[model samples]
Target: MRESLKVQPHHLERDAYLYIRQSSMRQVVENVESTKRQYALRGRATALGWRDEQIIVVDNDQGESGASAAWREGFQRLVSDVGMGRAGIVMGLEVSRLARNNADWQRLLEICALADTLILDEDGVYDPTSFNDRLLLGLKGTMSEAELHVIKARLRGGILNKVRRGEYRCTLPTGLIYDQSGNVRLDPDTQVSETIAHFFDTFSRVGSACQTVKAFRKDGLLFPSRLRNSQTTVFRPLTASTANAS
Candidate 1:
């Protein structure tokens, strides 16, 4: 049997994972250029003699801030792959591709070291096994951390701009409507809406959801569905009978 190749030239076994991301709106909306840049990474993998099947390339089309590892699905999966021994080599444009946050970058580099994977950057190929490469990784991770700070400031400014427009920024409750003409109006033809109001009034009348349910039940009211959670999304309580009903 042929000798099993170690990370050195004698060893030829390598499974490559390519992580591709375009973090800004400018990068996302530019269909042609962004894709070509990403595909170039694939071409790079091919040049290294990695088969199409052996190379894993993942793409995310979101304005999602990569500064924090908490929000990136692709990054999380890549980390998991490295940890699980699936990825023998990890390739990306820069350390920022792994994380913008300092903590995530440190943790990922450590994991790659422990798992014995090769990390490739444009500057050089990093093997955590070597002390010099580890130092380089630490420096790159620090730079990524700084880049994240700038991205956060820009995002916070944009959110404040939205709030300044008097648009209710968060989730809206049922009775309110943001109409076609950009007006916040109350919905008029809501039957469940009226019933829901009555349920709330009953809650105020009885002082508890249980008492509301009991009193409504005493009045032969119908409930749509029962839920036990505090943040229950479904509510179907019967409304007061109209006096005009024959």
Candidate 2:
């Protein structure tokens, strides 16, 4: 495979990096196939003559956005290694995994070109220094960036439409919930409703959130709160911030 792709002896001397990333935590959890495919690039590297020791998988950026590379430590490390002439080939599932920002993608391209590093994806192998390969990679980067914009715009438009129709549902903090028809309504629990109503009424009378919390604590009452991981209600001391938010 290395011979077919023109992988030279010098290119095999340094490390081969398998860079992996996902746009968000939800994708990291739901898109198992994509993540597995990216890791499988390790086998491709080995088949290209790089030994197991020479392969490095940078996966710290999982569950991170590729729209920018500023906060991606894994990408930073990959670029640093390439710039320092420690990487022979940088591989990813695709260009989007490297970066969805053109600036970051171009910067990586420049570094790889200068360091004589190869870039590999499922499509094929590419030498950044080569004009044809560089041009194709540049186009991929631009398309990736544009794709991100298109997705954002589409999602934003849908959300705005939903909001206009009063259907833009969000998680209710407490004392409220969506009915079967998706309309917002107060919680069905009588005790929960009374507690929340009393909290608001007390706060209104005291004219201070801090005072309301103090009154609740003085009365030895446990403030009701919704558990994060479950719908079950729990009782705890009222926090000033929670009081204010309510």
Best by lDDT: 2
Note the residue pairs that clash in candidate 1. Answer: 5-11
Residue 233, model 1: lDDT of 36
Per model, state how many residue pairs clash: 1, 0
Give all candidates' CA lDDT scores: 0.67, 0.91
lDDT of 1 at 203: 76
lDDT of 2 by residue, 18-85 (tens): 99999888899999999989999998888889999989999999999999888999999999999999
- Spell out the clash pairs found in candidate 2: none
Candidate 1, 80-159: lDDT as tens digits: 98898777677787777556788888888888888788777555567776698889899888888887777779988888
Q: Model 1 compared with the native: what TM-score?
A: 0.59
